[model samples]
Target: MTVYDFAKSVVYGVFKPLYRVEATGRENIPAEGGVLLCSNHIDNFDPILVGMMAPRPVYFMAKEELFKVPVLGKLVPHLNAFPVKRGMSDREALRKGLAILKEGKVLGLFPEGTRSKTGELGKGLAGAGFFALRTDAQIVPCAVIGPYKPFRKVRVVYGKPIDFTGLRQGKGSAEQATELIMSEIRKLMESSK
Candidate 1:
């Protein structure tokens, strides 16, 4: 098995029971072709939890510093993670993201750019919208509900693929696209209430 598959199995094995995690609407994930999996970030394990429940392998763009840590740095790469310089227009990171989508892979992104301390949905950065506008990849909104406290049930809900047909043309800006993405995510979060 690939490292991603093995790691996913291991993570699912450990986190599912511990957190009593349940995933819904997994069928929303397109079985093939590139996919942009956008979600709101909560805890540090948000990425792990999302990846664990994803129907397909997901490649994430993590912060550049994460690749500098001891063992995690070396391991994250194998887990299909690459580093991106936050708080600026990191062209290299943007290029890498586009390439992943062009290759028909799932590029997971936390559109808020960082985890929310208040556990509330935050504004989405234009980066995700840029990718969406640039590629034909399916945009799938995901929401992770509940606290990370052990024994608490956490629900990871994947919403239906977004229809960006109108936004694809030269008429829509990336900021507009991002707002739409965030609205869909907000809807998902509200539905879980």
Candidate 2:
């Protein structure tokens, strides 16, 4: 394996148990090739929870501001976390996500634009759906529950993949397609709760 992969694997493996992770339905994540992981956002550490539990490396789109820290900017990319500009199209981020898929890597994303400050689910953005449709990659729906600070049990539940190829048959706008994709994620998130 490459240096980056080694580093990420070790880091995640080391922290996997510290969070008291309890995951189920891992078979939902396909064994090979590109995949889009659609999940809900509830905390700043949500990415870590999912990434650590996943059987494979999963990339995240973090806000640009978060990358400004001297050490993180250098280390994040190594861990497969790229920056996304908040409140904007962030074409660069989208392009990077697509490229990762084209390179046969995994992309983990929360349809929600940001963390759920109110501890409730939020309407999801369409980027994850777009990436899946554009690359013909499978999407694994997931739900995460926990707050590491409370010393609580953290759980990440994986669900079956949502295939979007069927929707391509009927006439549908990008917006419609996005909603349909988010709806599937929503159902998985709810069921895992």
Candidate 3:
């Protein structure tokens, strides 16, 4: 098995028993194509949870700093994660993201740009929208809820794909698209209540 599959199995094996992990709306994910999974960031484990729940392999753009750590830096890339500099436009990261989509892979992204320590959804960055528009990939709005506490139930909900076909890519368009994605994520989060 690939490193990703093995790591996923190991994570799922541990997480499923320690926490009540529930996933829904997975059918909304495209079977084969370039797609973006836009999600709310709650904890560092969010990517692992989402990747475990997704129907297909999910690649994420992690912060570049994570890659500097000795062992973790060497391992994360094997599990389909690459580093992106947070708080600024990292053109290299964007190019890598676009290339992943073009190759018909599932690109996972947290539009908030960083984890929300407050447990509330934060404003989304425009990068997610820009990637969606640039690659003409469907945006799957995802909501991951619950405190990352042991024995607490964490829910990961996937919403319908947001289509941006024929949408012009520009300054205003990217902001609008980000808003739409955030709105859908909010809806999904509310539904879990």
* TM-score on alpha carbons, each prediction: 0.98, 0.88, 0.95
- What is the per-residue lDDT of model 3 for residues 85-148, given as tens digits with 9 covering 90 to 100? 8878999999999999999999999999988989899999989878877776778999999888
Compute the lDDT for candidate 1. Answer: 0.94
After best superposition, candidate 3 residue 186: deviation in angstroms?
0.7
- What is the C-alpha lDDT profile of model 1 across 1-193, one tens digit per residue? 9888999999899899999999999999999999999999998898998888998989999999999999989998999999999889999999999999999999999999999999999989999899999999999999999799899999999999999999997568999999999999999999898
Clash count in backbone of candidate 3: 0
Q: Report the C-alpha lDDT of model 2 over 8-85, residue by residue, as the tens digit.
A: 577567556577678898888988988888888888878877877788889989889878989877777777789999
| Top TM-score model | 1
C-alpha lDDT (0 to 100) for residue 178 of candidate 3: 84
Which scores better on lDDT, 2 or 3? 3
In terms of lDDT, the best-performing candidate is 1
- Per-residue lDDT value at 112 in model 2: 83
Q: In model 2, which runs have C-alpha deviations exceeding 4 angstroms?
A: 1-17
Off by over 4 Å in 1: none
Question: What lDDT score goes with residue 142 in model 1?
Answer: 97
Better of 1 and 3 by lDDT: 1
